[model samples]
Target chain A: MTGDGQSQARPRFEFRRNTWILAAGFLALLCAVNYFLQDNFFEPGVMVSNLTTFTPLILIAIGQTYVILASDIDLSVGAIVSLVNVVTVSIMHHLGGDALAVAAGIGAGVATGLAAGAANGLCVAALRFQPIITTFATGTVFAGLALWILPDAGTVQAPEPVWRTYSASFVGVPFVIWSLGVVALGCWLYSRSRPYLTLMAVGGNIRAAFGSGLPVMRTRIAGYVICGLFCSLGALALTGETATGDPLIGIAFTLSSISAVVLGGTALSGGVGGVLGSVLGAILLGLISNVIFFAGTPFEYQNLIQGVIVLVALAGGVFVSRGGAR
Target chain B: MSAARERTRSGPRWYRHSLVLTLAIIVVLFAAGETLSPGFAAPGQVIYLLVTASLLGFVAAGQNLVILGGREGIDLSVGGMISLGALIAGNVMDASNAAILPALLATLAGTFALGAVNGLGVTFLRIPPLVMTLGMYGVIQGLLIVITRGVPSGRAAPMLSAFVNEPLVLGIPGILFAWAAFAAFVIWMLRSTAFGLRIYAIGANENAAALSGVAIRRTRVLLFALSGMCAGLTGFLVLGFSGNVFIGVGDQYMLPSIIAVVIGGTSLAGGIGGHHGTVAGAIVLVLLQSILTTLNIDPSGRAMIFGGTLLLLMFFYGRQQRLRV
Candidate 1:
């Protein structure tokens, strides 16, 4: 890997051997703090509610892990979430809120998500457009489409049962937990699969990967498709949580999810991290916000505080990982 | 790495013709817009668009330099800087004519310093520019609410608004002259100055530039600072033009400034574009915007059109000819 004389000169962040360890420690620390700050912090009912709130970020961050692992970024996933949410909610509304309608709605929503992912993939992998800018543009388009479908927040709503099922429990576990578990597990299994390894090969060194006869373009495209799939899942959860088709709701999730991805120990540079960290990172982010709220931070300063904390965490990770080498 | 080496000094033939192409776009947009919207080319409407275009031009100039500095050079914090600059101006001026100088100084100093921090993170801490600026964006956004107490305050001094909105000479807005002065300085620096050359060298090939004795860190930091200062200037200008400010004043310009740079034919890959095209690019963007405005599409439609146009423009000339081929 270090054979390239040219790459020797380029500085790479020497991340900790296992970032999930750091994530777990931080998560534990936060959980302990929550125990003191709030009553019944560990109660299954309260925990499930919190996890429910955390579901979308957790799922989207996992999806982002794939793209970032491939050394590409998707700025559009949040917009995708918004678009899917509106699409799902709208379809359900128009088709009449029965079980059949919900099925159709979710199916259509997934299609929208896949379509967005394909657009990003084609733009970057096929056309070689810059990932950051292309995704930004696509995200803008997706958001606009969301707005077009749902002109106003209250114009359409997911049927009561649609959301009820989301909030409802199954197999002795909450729906959020079940969904989060399934998605996170999929990410875990994929991380060990050949396709995931191929993505890493591409990300670690695109030229080398190409030279080795890897399906460089197709594998990279698959990463975005996976991201899109997760974004659609995120939208489903969000629609359930909010019970409405709100075009603008998912905008903030973009930055927050990125933060979670980084915090989870996934390198923005790609090929060096996994979904486990992202999952924990998303939960960690949720906990940080919870701590801020529990600490009674004024509404105006909550966002600022969370941003500062995340930045410090990022800078601190880099600083520590460098470990006096600098 | 080989992909980068493939880029020779002589760009595609179209690179040489970008300025002409940009001008042609502006013309076509004007003709089409006039035909579709009636009165689209009226002198008053055109002047107003140029005035707004100038506002965006200032930020795009900054974006141009950053992109030129290479290493994934992009200042995503620009939107935040613009918003922060506006808030700083609003606070320092507090609606008083006498406070204008102080407001200008504070906005410049504050944003420049903040931007430098971004550079330090990128250079010293080795944070990716996208992640660094993206984080900075969040911080600035949160600071916006805190600074504004959740609502913006202060008004544009009537005198300042006159300078921004009213023609000062030959029926041209004062802002355009101001922008011209700034653009002239920027262009001259890029073409005539050693500092300009260093950024270009650094962007073109960092290791080579470093081996050749260029001070990479200082130049990189300086570029980010300059970008911040540019965004700050736009903030004050925006305040003057609107006669007021808001938490999201600079948000609108975020994509447009980058779009302007790209549309102007500045390659996002860095090292291959210039401010002259960006200036033309700014005008092109405003013209397209005007046409879209006249299209009477809802906000959603406008956004989709803008995004669609960006994809087409980039696909046409900006992308690497192909990923594998």
Candidate 2:
């Protein structure tokens, strides 16, 4: 009934044929550069701190990978994060900063993220609004809602246990490290699943996929939903990190996530690349910022230099992949 | 047979004219404004709306041109270009206003160069227009930061300030005159010029246009450059209107310009719309903004409503397309 039947029967298990080798290499290079730029770059404390910083982006970028792979985009992911963060903090504050309240807040945050994703999905896939602009509009709505919920940035001290557990280690390993492992494993399992292939097919050619009996709309919508879910996770991580509700917190994540996806070698046109590459891309971006800061570049020029580096990385990835493909 | 059905199903002659539909919307919005507050119909208020719309009109003109150039053409860098242009012009123009012309020229030239880079990447390198322009957006923004060192300084030319605020003729604001002249020139260029026809032809069907000997690559590149120039001009106007510059001054224009074009009935898929419609669309948005302000809606509520309106408009436009199909 599907092309996957024939492809699955083949002897070669060629998963990740389109994995972003260039991005992985670039990330490695940046890691090496960072090692030299910062003192004690490999120290456990520094590494944990760095990984914690990269975690939320890693989560968001991974979700964005699904949407981009389905040949769509979700600019609203950052907004979803903002909304979830504010909602989580507000809920906790309202319900009192207890264990049950924090748990309930987390649940509420996840629900809000899912709802936003569903709204974007319905508009883009069901309504057939242009993906980029639709998500952009929806993103503005989400950001507005976030601001409305928390008129301004403020701190809501989570129950000590919440931040403690988030920052603490189990068996001498940081909690973030364990969370990263869980996320990586989840992505790995999902990549091997049927829905992932369906998403890839839909992105590769929507008409063709539909003709072949794939649930095109459903797959695309699911991609967005998953993206929203991951953004919620990112928000949870952010809450742990900042313990605050800032309507403006996730604004930078929007472009940065897109950059990470592209930097991971996911074609903006879609149907290529994977989460692994996006993870590497996210790390690369984080490291680039770190290196800039450590190198003592004027604080003002930091963004300028960072932008230049992303462009260079993007161009390099494109050139290398095109060269390799040819 | 399907094509015939599409033609018939397009309904009345007025329905087929998106510009008419947009104009009708403008009238409706005006009526709503009047009903909500009688002062909305005042000549002064109308003039204010047109003047602000014209500022947005400049940016939308460039955006419309790029969108009309096809192949998923969109210039996300317009906002950055606007900011860069205003910042550069503000910093360069001296107190005596002697350097105004040169500053304007330099800003436009700089913007043109940046747009050209985007054009080159999209056309030759086969980069998606969105990504290329977005990358350029980042680059321009970074350069702006580096140049301004975070704090934007300098003043708008006094002449520009006078021109913007003062009435030039018959109680009409001077900026309206500038907008009218610019709009007329753009409309003429788009309607009567070979380049304009090429733009439309390429947008309608790039492969077909190429086969028919349209300079697809050249036209697209030029269109982006032109869009950049429009942004530069918009920046100059913004500086004049505001009497100074800031890092985020141009931030608000990016999405609104696209919204104006979209509302104007320019298909994001390209081809099938005109600058005249965009003019109406710009006015409509300005009118809506004024009404919202008069109602004293919070900025967040305003943003949400604006976004919701954009989605609704897109949904309706998309439904029309689907029905035609």
The models' CA-based lDDT, in order, is 0.83, 0.82
Stretches of candidate 2 exceeding 4 Å from the true structure = A1-16, A319-326, B1-15, B319-325
Best by TM-score: 1
True-structure Cα RMSD, model 1:
3.2
Kindly list the per-residue Cα lDDT of model 1 for residues A1-326, writing each as its tens digit.
11211242334444443556567778999999988899888998889889899988988988898899898999998899999999999999999999999999999999998999999999999888878778988998999999998889977889999889998989888888778778767777887789988998887788778989999989889999999999999989999999999999788788878888887777676776677778888999899889999989999999899878877776654433232235
Candidates' interface RMSDs, in order? Answer: 3.6, 6.3
TM-score of each: 0.94, 0.93
Model 1 docking category: medium
Model 2: residue B60 alpha-carbon error in angstroms = 1.2
Ten contiguous residues with the weakest lDDT in model 2 chain B: B1-10
Question: Which clashing pairs does model 1 show?
Answer: none
- In terms of lDDT, the poorest run of 10 residues in model 1 chain A is A1-10
Top candidate by DockQ: 1
lDDT assessment of candidate 1: 0.83
Candidate 2 lDDT over A235-297, as tens digits, reads 999989888889888988998898888888776666767888888889898999899999899
